[model samples]
Target chain A: MTWHVVTGGAGFIGANLVRRLVQTGGRVVVVDDLSLGRREHLAGLADTLLLQLDAADAGALAAALRMVPDGPVEVWHLCANSDIQKGVTDPSVDLRATFLTTFAVLEVMRTRNWRRLHFASTSAVYGDHGTTAIHELTPTLPVSNYGAMKLASEAIIRAACETFLDSARVFRFPNVVGLPATHGAILDFTRRLIADPQRLAVLGNGMQQKAYLHVAELVDAMLFIRDHADGPHRIYNIGPEDAGIRISAIAEMVRSRVAPAAAIAYGTEARGWVGDVPRFRYDVSRLKALGWAPRLGSAQAVARAVDEIAQQEFCRYDA
Target chain B: MTWHVVTGGAGFIGANLVRRLVQTGGRVVVVDDLSLGRREHLAGLADTLLLQLDAADAGALAAALRMVPDGPVEVWHLCANSDIQKGVTDPSVDLRATFLTTFAVLEVMRTRNWRRLHFASTSAVYGDHGTTAIHELTPTLPVSNYGAMKLASEAIIRAACETFLDSARVFRFPNVVGLPATHGAILDFTRRLIADPQRLAVLGNGMQQKAYLHVAELVDAMLFIRDHADGPHRIYNIGPEDAGIRISAIAEMVRSRVAPAAAIAYGTEARGWVGDVPRFRYDVSRLKALGWAPRLGSAQAVARAVDEIAQQEFCRYDA
Candidate 1:
């Protein structure tokens, strides 16, 4: 029997990862601050197996790790502040919560000698890559504080893997959009549509494209990399082809799902905000070469995410 | 009469700036934690006033700033973890003390509505630019955690200037070597030679190259930029004309200053250590256009620094 440790497990992607890990029949322990990560997010899944500990607090994380039952521990490090647009408004929160907090988790894990680790990184680290298909080797120069912090975390993880932990796979997620997440462009649009019901307000021009992946596909790729890769540490840009999604389409989907007659209005800027990427198309052929193909392209994934997000909101109406 | 509020006033660059301010007959108020800064570093500079206060400690900084009753305050923000090499060995220290500390100071200034700010930045933000003449426009993708933190600080400064503060100047300094009262490469080498007097262990193959400017020239550039530039914000890379100094040459200069029999040893790597940049050059033509230049080239600066360091060390021995 093996025990899997997942930090930020009660987070959007973390909870989804937990659901997948549950199916695999491994003893699972989740560590979350319960600040952004909710108890209800991991509701039925918690049955003495879940360990709710703050990832940013090293003392709590160390104590939590010690509490792990006698088994082979495979850790998944996925905790961070995942909002880029908000970073422009207040970058201090992003740097402290993301960079400082990530450093804390890395140091703690290194002390515990957690050999196997999978890091859930973000595509924002690449910034605006000139609409080319960005790969793992792409020179990352982040334009925003959030992206900078994520890039810092990626570098720290890579260094830790090279020096301390031998097994580390860094996955740069391309817009992991799905249901009930507190924040996302899709959720943001859906909420606006539900409120206005007649006029849909959109940030940036609709031409701003990006690769969006469903939560399941993201977790699948993560698991595949964890189970498969050997030799030196791996850096994978996890994205699907059809490579970019149009914001207009997401708006339309949300409008139709919530308010059928809503008119979409653009802010006239080419990009969403100062920190938001206008377009990001990843060259994820590396992951495809590793025997994993996404079930949905960017458009399909965004559509699915829109429906899921709307349904979750509608569930609130029923409540 | 204009008052200069020099943050990190006890640090190397800050002390140099304070000296210049004092000489120019400007009212000066300095704030420093004296972490790496020394009281002796700013001794006998007869003009300006000094306050022992941590820039990051909000209550301390606020109380110190309140003590400035001379005129409207002008900020020269120079405090930081100055050594890039130390960043690799001690990242956590630099990360908190440099980046986070800088942010706190900026926040305090912002709250005070301080008009003019001069940020003392480093060229390390450019990372390994591969011997190219890096300009202010060069894309900053730092390799070391220290560089990343500095880059982060620069980003915040830029934002504060553009969005928060009205007038600000950012100085991206190269290795500003000088006959300072306190510690530096020259001082370190002299002390090491005096201690052993037989064998000198220099880090790297000693091929690392970087632009060097006497600290006075750097301060002069800052004064020039402050007097001329009129806009939301301006940034200039301050370096020498030939662009840089060779590390091997600096070693020989230090050896020449010491007993000649001392053999030099390399760390046996192309780089000094993990985060060391083996080759660096700068394009400081912008500051040159602003009508200020370095009085000494890299080797000359090193020789002068070596002599000053030797004299200082000899005095200490006599004491």
Candidate 2:
């Protein structure tokens, strides 16, 4: 039986991945700091194997792994200061949560070799270079501290990968949506409509566009790359089938889906909040060559996320 | 009547700046963990207000600030884990020390605004863009984790400036050399020559060209900028007249000055070390426009550094 360790186990993406692993009869271990990830998310599975502590502490991480009842032959290192937009106001908070956390995981893995590690990197790593379709080879010039730190961690991991690890795959994911626990543009619109059905306040001049990829599709792509590729080093872009969708269309889709009576309001500012990715379109031929395409397009993914966030009482659990 | 605080103030460049600050009749505050910085560097000015602590610790920095006899404060935030080639080997150590430490300073500064702060940035922030003349407006695309973290800190500082503190000045300096106690191309070459005086093992093919600035020139320009500029924001390049230099020439210079009799052995396998700045020079006409330039050219700076290092005993003092 295969054993898997998902670092951010109680969070939206990690929990879903844990459920998937459990359904497939794989032994799974989860380590969550619970700052953002809720303990209730992994309530029933507490006995299944959980570590309730910060992942940024390498010692704590090692101690948590030692407590795991079963061995984790493979690792999905998704624990990070995962919020890209959070760095604008307080970049240090983001660095501690994301960059230091990444470093900690790398350090832990340095001593303990694993079958593979699937990193949940974001396309935000590629900063504001108004490109139509960017590739893995495109030089990353991050406009935000979030992207800069993530890219910095990736560079460190490059050196770490030099060691004899089985494999390491860095998946530069597009805006991933569709989850058991939802909080994103889709969810925001759904909530805004719920609060005031007559008006929706969207940031920016409504020209911001972002690439969307379902979390399941992203996780699947990550697994596919890890299972197939024998790369000591691999950097792949995981994105949706469509190029991307404009912010205006997403707002409309959110309005129509949740509150048909609401009027969409654009925060006709020069741009979205500081550090918001204005344009995101990735060339995923690298992953496509490995025979894996996202099941849902950007629009479809947004719609799905809206439905889930509106229907599920996940927000109460998230906050 | 200037009381200037220099974090990492005991480091190579920091010490150099401290020297100039003292020479110009300025009261000084030096903050250094001495992980790399040496205590001996600040020997003569034991009574000049020095803080021998990690700048990353909020408590420590606060204590240091409070310890300082309050005067009109002007801080030169020159603290960082300053080594690009070494960071390629282990990126996280430096990133945490550099990025997190700066984060602490920014947070502290937010509470107690310095009359003005001058940030000592680096040309490494540009990374390996293969460009000859890099500018303040040049697109930053760093190839190493060291550069990445520095660039991230820059973004963080810039954002803070725009919103939190708009008066901070950023000086992206070229490869600064001259009587550094800790590390540099000159230090590395000196150590290599000492280790194997018969043959020196260079990093790359000795062809990695870069703009070199003397620390004396850098600090002088920084002080000049502090005295003159009164704008919403300031970002000026401080470097030598020669925008670029081949590593081969640097190797030759080191050999001649430190160990002429020692043979030169090059690590001629590649164009650069793991994270060496292969190419990309700086244009410091902005500093020149301010009527401040390095007194010595790249060669002169190298030769002078060699003379100083040769005269001084190795591992004798801190910095």
Candidate 3:
């Protein structure tokens, strides 16, 4: 039996991916600091070993790996400082959480001679490319510290794969959304409407648009690419084919689902925050060429995520 | 007067750049850890302030910046782990020295509101692109920790420029050779020949080819780009127009100059070391378009560097 190590595995996408891995009968080990990842997310998964430790600490990570049974290990390195605004406020947040975590993991892999690694990169690495469709070949000029660190991690991983690793896959994620949503537009809107049912204050002009992929579909594509990709190192953009949904549409969807009577107000700024990229288009043709694509489009993914978040937060959906 | 802060200013390229900055009458401050950078490199330069501290230490760097007189500042971030083999042996060497130094400098710049920056990037960021003439737009897939960290630094700088910096110029350097040499093929050859004086042992198959640029010309292009570049961020590959010089030819050049009777023996590997890129072609069209070019070709640069290294090493030229 192969050991599947998932960093940040107690978080949103990680938890979802963990469920899939468990269902596939893989012995899974989760490395999470629990700073952002909730242990309850993996509550029902009795077979998975949860190592509540910082992934950036190589010593802790090495100890965790030692606890696992000896076998071929595949690491799903999804660990990162997901909050872009926090990274903008404190660059070290991303530097340590995102970039250092990858570094530590790669170092461990090198020392142990363990090979396979699947990394969660971000579309933010493309920066504000405007409307230009970002393919795998897009010039990565990140605008945010979070994006910068993620790009840095990718570069390091690329180097490791070229030098030591047997193979590594880097998936540049679009905005991921689904059940057990920790933080994002849908969750933010849902919580706001829950607190003040009469008012919904949205960030930016609500014109910011971005592609979204449901967590389940994202997991499917990750596994598909893992089994199919046949190179020492590869990078693929994983996202829906649609252009994206505007922030305004997402706000309305959440408000309508949670509280239809809420009055929505928006900030005049074009972007949501200091490091926000208002718009981008992901040309996931590379992933598509491997005969894999997300099951839901951006709008449909957002719609499903809104309902899922409402149900997860409130235990029931009024709509 | 404008304050010019050069990290690693006591090293080869940095020392040369400091000499030029002093000649131009700029108030210069140098930050070096003195680990690889020799303090004597800046001897007799009475006007320059030297801060013997690690550039990766943000607090130390910030304190050093405060010591300088209040004025507009230009940070020439040249500090890095120059030894590729050492970085390959210990990844943290590059991570802390190369990547963190840039991060610390940018952070200090952001906090102090001092914007101008000139980063010493490397052609290693391009990795082993084979014979492809690497332009600024070429995909950067670095294969060495040194190269990876440099790429990471570039990404962080790019983000900083997009967010906080007034302007930044990233110059991708080819193999630089000149007087006051710290490390490189020519210096290695000279030192080895000096020690043995009979047989010269060459790393790699001696077929490894790469562009060489004299420190004088590199300093010239750096200042030229700083003065002429108009954008918030710009990247230029600084190298000679010719293809490059082979390792065998360089070995011959050094052998002929240092030990005329020495027999050269080459390693079987194509690359000098694990992280070494055996060959690369730098497309200097970007810098050329800016109306700047290196005065010496690769062969000429190697020849000049050979004589300079011999003089610096032996205090006289035998050739």
Leading candidate by DockQ: 3
For model 1, residues A1-319, the per-residue Cα lDDT tens digits are: 5678888888899888888887788667888776667767777764325666657777777776787755357888887776766666786777766776777777776677767878877887766777788888675656677777777676655545434666778888988888447688888887787778899878887888778899888988998988887765678888897667788878887887889998888888988778677888888888889899899998888888888988988787689
Better of 2 and 3 by lDDT: 3
Tens digits of per-residue lDDT, candidate 3, A102-138, equal 9999988887778899999999888888988999877
Better of 1 and 3 by DockQ: 3
> What CAPRI-style quality would you assign to candidate 3?
medium
Candidate with best TM-score:
3
Q: What is the lDDT of residue B273 in candidate 1?
A: 70
Residues A91-189 of candidate 2: C-alpha lDDT, one tens digit per residue: 766676767777787777765665467777778777666856888877565656676667766665664554434567888878878766535777777
| lDDT values, one for every candidate | 0.76, 0.73, 0.90
lDDT of 3 by residue, B58-84 (tens): 998998788876668888999999998
What are the RMSD figures for all models against the true structure?
Answer: 4.2, 5.4, 1.9
Worst 10 residues of 1 chain B by lDDT: B155-164
lDDT of 1 at A184: 84
Candidate 1: residue A46 Cα off by (Å): 9.4
Residue A240 in model 1: lDDT: 93
Residues B194-251, model 2: lDDT tens digits: 7677888776777777777667777788888888877856788887777567778888
Residues B1-319, model 1: lDDT tens digits: 7788887788777788888888888877777778777888788877566787667676677776776674467888888776666766666766676777777777777678776788888777666779678888775656566677776676666545534677878888888777554565677778899999898888888877877887777888899889987776677888887857778788789888886789988777888777666788888788878777777887777777788778988889989
